[model samples]
Target: MSFTTRPTLQGTFGMVSSTHWLASQSAMGILERGGNAFDAAVTAGFVLHVVEPHLNGPGGEVPAIVATARDPRPTVLCGQGPAPAGATIAHFRSLGLDLVPGAGPLAAAVPGAVDAWLLLLREHGTLSLAEVLEPAIGYAAAGHPLVGAVGATVTAVRSLFEQHWPTSAQLWLRGGRPPVAGERFTNPAYAHTLRRLVEAGQAAGGDREAQIEAARRAWGTGFVAEAIDAFSRRPFRDSSGRAHAGLVTGDDLAAYSATWEEPATLDWRGHTIAKTGFWGQGPVLLQSLAILDALDDGAYDTASAAGIHAQAEALTLAFADREAWYGDSADVPATALLDPAYARERAALIGDRASRELRPGSPGGAQPRLPDHVRSRVTHRVDVPDPTTGEPTVRSDGVTRGDTCHVDVVDRWGNMISATPSGGWLQSSPTIPELGFPLGSRLQMCWLQEGLPASLVPGRRPRTTLSPTLVLRDGEPVLACGTPGGDQQDQWQLPFLLRHLVGGQHLQQAIDAPAWHSLGVPSSFYPRESEPGVLLVEDRLDAAVVTALRSYGHEVRLADAWSLGRLCAVSRDPATGVLAAGANPRGMQGYACGR
Candidate 1:
């Protein structure tokens, strides 16, 4: 009846949504083959690695929130690997560096996405490892159409590939030129690597779990780990314009394993929202929800200027706490930070006008200390803008950047999952010729400061920006959603939740709505810059609303009409056996499929 970019797909069987169409189709195919949501999701995850190589790869990391049909409680699948055993603040400072480089092996964590996916398959999935990996392997070996963004990303970093990372040049450039958009591009090396993993799994015989474990061992302790260790030892150029060897080794790879953990959850307006722990930026969403719930119902009106101001201000407060306290440490005051009293105190700080200061509240009278890089706004220069080098931004400069990828799947049996897989872009680091992928630069999120929550430490997970969300209603899993923006992942989801959960909009209508996010908190990416009072909004929002936002002492910047959010979501109705899905139309890549 009303305008929407596409219909919110409704069916009785299954639903899948992802950043790319090929991945969406592959997942739907798995579901059609009688596989459950976990199997479909694993298929999509691997296919995404092949198709969206500019955004994610086999060497990256992923974190997912999942709920099984049998057990309807949310659980976090932590695929985010930790800093290597040798990665210490002292070691970095001794190398004449104040912060990790944005793009190099020195910024790499142990590869985690592949292991994490395998773990999920081994524990929850119904299909064999080879069965789920088939689509990605086929795409890699037989060639898939290169998207325009991927081509442009390669062109932007062509000089770097040619001069410093020749191995990368060899893989990405054919006949001394970057692949053209829409042309079929093949990566035989990646295909071979995946096929070898399948062989390793098959060699273990017909036990699905054992087969998966064998493949996991092959990745961790066998040839894959050896290749990474040897290649990372070579000096490579990074964001700092210097050549440095990485700290990762075969031991780091062998020691790391994807684990399952309890999620940080908050109940609001009869719906329970779940996210990863303080180690990720996921809890910031929960904190923001707590702050918003403390306000009047009128504040939930996402289409209004006053409501937008309220949401941005609340997120600003939550992200400030993220900077001060959130990390992969036991000392995080998470319980106190999510207390109702703390939310009220934080809510009371929001005013009619935007606040330009970074204010982190004291939870339970504890002192909140922010890192020096955040407090002093220290920044470093990067010569080239790689796809995953920095936070997702709408810059006035001609620099191009890419962030992450997301997939959400829901099956007929009530199995649901939301995963954000990212890092290890083609330009993140030099590609390993044998593996056909580069190590992820996730350590760029850590600071060199000692005694801080996010300080670089051996065997500690870097505080990551990858956050996926799952929601339950009436004791059943109802919604799974996430996006790929660096710091804005949760910021964008806030308004979507408000519109759909409270305002009662259709899934597609909610996703098609104009989006905005605050840049008031320290970024979780390289250089870690923060803009105190800035808010970026899609220009499609009411012109009068933009004027009103500026009147509220907010520095508002207008982006293209559909450029703010790249979110994907899927939902299941327990009462009616109905499934629905939606995908962002911003990039013209994301797709949603269902029966």
Candidate 2:
């Protein structure tokens, strides 16, 4: 039953797995230095920003699920920034735009990743700020080998950068061309930007916590904020093929900070699953699981065709609810939507045929009010050239900043974390001269209309696609796992969860299994589109299974084997205090390290 090409790495001290090897190495270095899991994770997070610029950047946002040794309960660290005060429906419409452009200053949200990482380190880490940031600074200053995907992305958008985003041209283009794959690439300006944070921390002249606070202030109200404010007035080209100035100002940056909240949880089959609130798509997995859990166990066997059908049908229905109900606004009926009784009722909708219709049921006897954008003409412009690949990875609008990355960490102390860090890709917007990074286009997830919870509003966080998962057994965290597939983040994670928790598969075995996601719901990103009755499954499945799925009226598309997900998972055994980790082999960029 093992599909994994590599065995899971097991250790007793610490474990870290991430989308990039350098990031994984950086975190392991901290653990070797006697730092805790929190310190190791934050270190990896920063390294990912420097090494995976096409996938993420320092100006990006990260929504993480953390369980500290002191506070064993899982909680979400909300790094997803809100829209600027000046970003209003009236102004966007005045610009002659029906929807915000995906990659431009106009689509930027206040950068929140820096503050969020610092906040986590300050509260739970045992390492000094200098210690944690040293590796990232070194790589950005000296150089790191660029990956092929980044080079391809840069080449694809090279002309755009040269024609309009001159700053990006100066930073990314080496010899006026995209850097060659495996070529040593350097970003001195980004190095300086990171150095400034270190200096600000040292100037505080107190304990580690106080120094971190000082750095956070410098990022929010000091130099970083000033730089972002000055750039807001400069117009730039966007995905809409129009140039427009962004509205984020210094005050917007200064007024904002990342916060911590208890995670949304669901208990079934003796294990507790933790996820971010409706503000993210984490609960879609919860709702889907609820539907599957209510059925006879054998009916959802992932290895069999029947199981795959049940999972896909349940996800289609649940994600329809995501389109119809999930959002960041207070108007979301999260509590009622997560109720078991409601989940059972929703489960009844699953049938033999692949559901081509968008069906969101009433929760607590209230009708779902979907946004006008979703109900409008659903376009078929997919960002990816084929079913196997695309920007924002698997499921999102054709318009987006770029793709995303993920990290998972666990320590001997039982602390575990799963984090998805994305947005503000180097290709998203022009690079700030001194900061060497662009603003995030996460605001594209918001709707322009009112009434829906995801309506565009100043100071409200967008319904982000960055999701991480933490699973607990008997009220203790046992696993921290996630991936980088935009709207498919949770969709891809669902099969792994079921295979591991219920199907008795090993962590790596589960991760290596073929997976699929429905594209029937409205995308979270701008220029949203949906394909009815479409199911993208890995080609590794048996020909009979593929044909069976097609017989169910699904427009089955064969995805390249090992091309579907970039998933990584880390597990800890409370009884023996042993830690095990696994990393995806699909991209050949992910790694797991522990000792």
Candidate 3:
């Protein structure tokens, strides 16, 4: 019955899995050297920045769920950066832009990934700063094999980089060309940047925590801040096809800091799911679970047409609520929206035909102020042809569903973390030559229109799609899992949990099961577009099941067998103290390591 390419690796020591093999190996190496999960994750996170530059960077954001052995209750580490103080709706509108550009300095948010990983390492880790950073520094200073996808992503926009982002060209291009895939590409400048951060930590005459705090200060208020400010002054072409100066300043970086927050949780079928609060899209899983929990029997085959239809409908309803209520603002009635009663009410709207509208109902009369783009029946189709392929760069509309990165780790001591890090991709903005990294374009998720929860507001987070999930069985932490797909992160992950928890499958079996996600809702990126009644599924599913789904009013599109998701998971059995891990094989890069 196993369709997996690799067996579920079980061990008594530790387990680490991620979107990239180098990161996973680096983490396992840390574990072998007696470092805890937090330290191992720090090492892996840094390496991920170097190896998967197109997916994430040091100038990105990572929101993580951390669970400890002593305290089984999970905690959310909010590393997602907020909008700069100068990033206001009026400021963007004054530039004659309707939506924030998806790529460029204008869409930059406060970079928070470096500080967040450092904070986790300083607080919960057993290793020194240098130990946690050594691997990534080596890979950057020397060289690491560049993956094909990274090369392709860079190639896709190589012409743009040469024309608009020369700083990016200087860093990414070898002989004015994209680095060859699988070649040993080195970033000595990036290594020096990390070295400076390490030196800052070493100079501070205090404990490990104090030193790490000093490093964070260096990143925010020191040379790094100055470099970011100077580079953003140069106008760059963005998704709007217009060049504009960015708004990020040194004060914006100084004013921000990573935080620890409470996670939203709910018990279902002997397991408790923990996710980020309303500021992110995590609660959609909780809400969807609520609706699914109300089903007559919870024992349906997940691969069946009935199961697929039910999950898609529930996700559609939940994402509708996301568009209306979920954001960084306090206007969101998160408690009421996640209520089982409300979920039951919403679930009642599911019909034989797929929902083709953005139907957000009243939650305590919250009166959802959804954006016109999200609710418009009229499609504002704008085509931007890619110079490289002579085809539309984006889809039917002007948006591309961008993605991020993830890492999951569970230690022998019962500590675990599931983190989704993204935003400041290499392709996001021009690289700051002095700092060797670019600022994140997360501000693009914010809307220019007012009165909505995700409205563009200075000093507030932009309601990111970067979400990670942790599962606890009977009040004890067991699983840390996540994936990398813009709005599809949770949708792609839900089925894995369903197959594992509902169908009693192993971790790898769950991960390797053909994945699919609904792209029916409006995308969260700039130039947001919606594809109503669309369901993108993998061809691995039974042909009959696919046909039956089409019969139920879904606009089915069959993707390659392993094209939909890049999920990774790590689980620790509370009773046996044994850990198991799995990674997606669709992309040749993902890896799982244990024992």
Candidate 4:
């Protein structure tokens, strides 16, 4: 894609991206068309599906949080599609299946993204759905350039696409091969779907029901439940051997519908942050913030080294607790995890030194502490061959990557939309005929154990890594930030945010700064279970810092400085009314614009 960077003369807005330039251009188009930030955001979301299908689409679950100038209080929209009411852990057990990986009809949930966008538009948007969707429709129909990120992703996942669904292979792979950068990629089927949505939306006159029906037609229906059934079958395999078709079918598509609920809000250290509890890892963020707030503010400044350490320690502890106790709130005591007293108790237990080992249950509760001075263990790394070259590449950990796109916008009226639409990596292999987009492989994120909290259950939401955040100063919107990195999302975001908010780094500087991550013991992904206490730092970090951390008894691995999440954000100065926007330089082309 062509790369052109120019500042917007009107109101300033920034786009951080991991997709292509066309996707970013789509959002700018919405702004130019007199649409508000929310409208532009929704438009961008739809466009990304067509331009960057490997990352996300209409069939994916979206967990988003939005802030409007009129209502400074941010609201968390549950863009997650819920598991079918008929799905259950027992069903899988009956079929003698333990784990379900990748996208399939069975992994599908009640997709809420389209409906969520409609709701946001209805509540605070200035443009019609038809208006917001025009860019996506046009791009999908006319085609766009395949930029670096899109080309790289396609090259990486081409094999999976070819083996899973014929239609997908037909669309993504040309002559049974992935296209390189600069290739013109077109999705006439997807384009037609977008056109239908626009046409139906235009005719609906803001009637949500009519618009949703139009979306259903555009995106095929009744595949969610069918996908579940396929998962219940033994030796799960589709007719193509790369996908499971029985688990997803046309009937399941008909039953799927998005739900709207009141957003969940939490007050942390006097800051009110909103997150959707209906699905995803939102509750984890809320709970983690609560635990952080319960601790001494002195322990967690954004700039101080000690503060950064404390923040990492706290997040690790919270994530550990999430793995152990967090699940579908409807089936568990989710609120208990957020209890202030419990959080304080948990924070008090974290010692200054590393724990050396993992403690399975709540470390703050009655669970015994892990052994002291535990020896580190390393496991054999598996080498998976690159689809295109047959060259072996190291698969660091087997944790399935989560695919998503994040956008944060602020309009002339001060309205802001911060959202991340995601699906765990690997869309279902077999395309559902006319749907165009693959259903999410979200079920793969769930643990296969019999008694675990995240075990499959009907209507339960997976603990997602997507976190869309909005920062406020004196009860007004100031910054909106988010990223896409599966579980690593918040882990990286927390540090970046602290650096920007507390370290006083400018927006672009904070995003451009080097970072580090800890894949502690009892690792979530495979091939590295015993390899705990390993700290992966961006190469840009001072060599001294790496040595110092190693001195503290940690295994440090150096990675490319820009190996972390893709960030997109916009900050509005309440005092000056000047909006500053910055896109991550490491990702695809992103820009800032407004009037």
Candidate 5:
């Protein structure tokens, strides 16, 4: 067998994988206690918030894909909060802004992850709301060891926190200083907030579903909403170097609810891949897969320079289409874009040399329109001063690390889920002292320009980068995987899928393989810059491979040997009732547990 950082966990019972070891172990405990996959996933999701506070919090968002044994078809759980009713292009234009501020309340959407988790627990989970939330509350109330990266992230934004948002400094700093790595940190305020929600549910009576609904209500129309609304009224400094009051009101929170939707799917090589709809960047993967499927089998050779060139070229085309065609608007030509004919036509564009232009294709003979901002600007410096200021993977120090968390769970009953939870970084906005967290800045993904499919609009979900994947064979889910790299989420996942599904590598071996992603397309985060014909690869890749890629006219850049992807995955064998899982080793945090 080929070398791997760790063995792919194998078992007949249950499996859990996530970006953090504590979350993976806690979820495994729930499964060992006889809770189903949905219950375990919910438990892990909440625990991730408390343990990985620099990455995610109660106010972030999650988009997940879930499949149950009784209902094998994949379904999407959309916890992505929409832009508040007051968020509009005209309003932003009046502020003399061409882009949404990347680090303030003005960039926040209605908080949605908490409600979505509660909804899943109410409908699919067997555990009580309090039971699923217990681990997270304990971690927050007691303490958890702070990781080194959290300290580095805090140090990056220490000055900003002290000079502008004192509330944030008050929550993240220790005795007016940055916390050291491995220190035991506690957020008693967040523990109290969760305790209050549980109490509200218990007061509603004995029915579990009613209790969960009560907690959801408490978040939306109750104390949670009240705290956020009151805090948003105060102007706070942002990436724009100006203080602005937020657009999210309690009414907007009251009007929001997490909902379920059908997944967008594609069939290739006898397996079906499912993802969130066009509103997210999920379709970029489907589109890339389609483009690759039309090419020869040699394109699947991830080790070859020719193979890498083929894949990167295919991704740039799909990303171009994503920028022009994918959005929450009714005008997104979803069907036409995924058609086989269109895929073949797009594949025909790839050649021996790299093309340095953004090429968006016309679907169904209609003209493609890109945002004028994307077309006019070549590059701009974005002030992502800290992990919270929009792009978590891209830091001001030039280090590329995932500042988000991911979890995957699969039980013996065949229930499986893959969820990517992100946003509400401790540095995103001023922390609400009462709630112990800040609002998310997801609205920065939307352009301030009007009439575009992804323009800022009230009640519209900002096109997010939190994409998760669920794969099925013969109508049963076999694999679930996801990562946290903002715009690079799907791009990084593509290579893993190709290595495992097409190249016949085992789960851990596939995840351990060197990974790369093209920076030729526009980034989904703030500044929205693009580097045409650029490909970033891990330095561990074969020297000859990198040299050949450059010879193909690609602008190749080498990153740290193990600093590209943080993929978490779980898989189940349908015929034999066996399960397996793998987690990324890049950050020394991701772990997989099973028995």
Candidate 6:
């Protein structure tokens, strides 16, 4: 792990959670200095670039939702960069390629994280950008220890560093060798960038435009140029001997401008949730919540077997709808999916028995009327039973990737910042040369064929699996939580949320308890048929319960009791006015404090 660990806090109340403790402490310090949640979050976000660069960076996209105690509504900030102006499905087809990773400049979209941070401060923050950035600057300059996780990550992605950008390889690898856990590592270049931003912010009188301009000046060009160089290097091997340096140029970065649009809102179970329509998977989460509510199950508690089963079924259906019709709301109208009446119709069609033979369908709001008794020819494979021992075969692997971090800040003033910054699964975009972050491989997550709502297109945002959530009780936020797992994010979060909210479990108990994920639905990245109705469960599940589920014809895969998609949560008890924060014991860390 090439990251640092330490925790510190300043305000009347504060909590910080990240893979790296030093980065968390950086944010805590901001709060102690009277900076609000937005300030602390911004401080954390910038520091993460230096400590957890692989998971997130200044060059990535961030989709956030913020609600100030003073303001009644949560504001949605769309930080997911859009597709390059020239990108399209036909382009990939023309190149005779099934899929391409790190699409370079051609896949680049205007980055919004930097601008989003500024917007957050302008709206609900009380600290200056310079003040917020101090911790990150200090870390970058002083250096920190490399952890086992960070070391392993660097080794795994060595090809990315060696073959992509020379500068990246030079910065991350010392003497052409990846750092081992516990080794001290420094990022002076990144440190300089942070210092520049701090100095510029101080000069700008703290205006949004001035602050953003300073950040852009520090990050934009050099980052974008390195990306272009990386693309030119052709890091990954393809089927053909010839390496393709996808279209990307320095000019794109020069012209890139982060744009702010009016946010999207949906009423779910009578609570208004904010989403940036097409940008990430924000809209999808809302749609799923709406679908679940329409089911109107009077006994939807996490402890009840029926409740868990029903929620899983509902998630499957909602995901199906997402595959068919969700995309950049800028190009498609997402409001149609929010209609409650339509969701009710969709909920009515779900059957109890497994429908093994089913295929993808067109996007129609919730559920369109299907002809009564109309039989379709598509047949799905039935779940194969393991008869030898009357036990289902279950296997689990530790699959990991970079790109994703979530921060939830609740200030003494009652303001909150629920932001999830991500990117890096794919490298930084080459088209926007020197811009530090990569464009999302989000296109790969969508169906390529025409007629689907998420079909590839230029300048359109892909349907992302990243979702930052906040749970409110009696019109006040009770919990701010989220995780970082490409598509598995929601799959992991929904269950934990139920356990904590409905099952009355404490934050750690809900997060550490056994969890399960269904493979019956389409994956956000891969588009393959014959996805087994396999449910991946943690080892903690009782053997008897596992057998019971298998008897219902569901394949089960056993995962390590401790996995990285550990849930981080901050829970507030309204009655007692007590706040508790917990980090997943499965390798991740978290902290809590109050005045």
Winning candidate number (lDDT) = 1
lDDT of 3: 0.84
Mark the regions of model 2 whose C-alpha exceeds 4 Å error after superposition: 1-3, 381-383, 386-401
Per-model TM against the reference: 0.97, 0.97, 0.96, 0.83, 0.97, 0.81
The CA lDDT of each predicted structure is 0.88, 0.85, 0.84, 0.59, 0.87, 0.56
Per-residue lDDT of candidate 6, residues 323-428 (tens digit): 5555663244465666777667556655554344333233443332221111222224423222111111111111122346666666666666567776643233
Higher-TM-score candidate among 2 and 4?
A: 2
Model 5 gets an lDDT of 0.87
| Model 3 regions more than 4 Å off | 298-300, 377-401
Name the TM-score of candidate 3: 0.96
Candidate 3 C-alpha error for residue 202, in Å: 0.8
Model 3, span 1-595: residue lDDT tens: 7667899999999999999999999999999999999999999999999988888898889999999888889999999888998888999989998889888889988888988998899779988888889999999999999987767777778888888888888988879888888989888888999999889988997578878888899999998988887887889888888788888888888988899999988888889999999999999889888888776553245888888898888888889899888998557887788787887888888877787888887887667777776767434333433211111133211133357889999999999999998877888888888777888788888988887889888989989998899999977889999998888888987888898888889988998787777767777876777678878788888999899999989989777777768889999888899899999887778899989
How well does candidate 1 match the true structure in TM-score terms? Answer: 0.97
For candidate 1, lDDT tens digit of each residue in 1-595? 6799999999989999999999999999999999999999999998998899888888889999999999999999999999999999888999999988878789998899999999999889999988899999999999999887777777777888888888989998879998898999999999999999999989999999999999999999999999999998999888777888998899999999999999999998999999999998999999999998898876788999999999999999999999899887437998999999999999999989999888999999999999887888543332333222222321212122338899999999999999999988887888999998999889988889888878888899999999999999988999999988888899989999988899988889999999888877787777677777878888899999999999999999777788878889999999998999999988889999998
What lDDT is reached at residue 294 by model 3? 72
Alpha carbon deviation, residue 571, candidate 1 (Å): 0.3
Instruction: State which candidate, 4 or 5, has the greater TM-score.
Output: 5
Q: What lDDT score goes with residue 456 in model 4?
A: 63
Error of 2 at 329 (Å): 2.6
What order do candidates take by lDDT, descending? 1, 5, 2, 3, 4, 6
> Model 2 over residues 428-462: C-alpha lDDT tens digits?
88899899888889888888777677877888888
Q: Give candidate 5 regions above 4 Å deviation.
A: 380-403
What is candidate 5's TM-score against the reference? 0.97
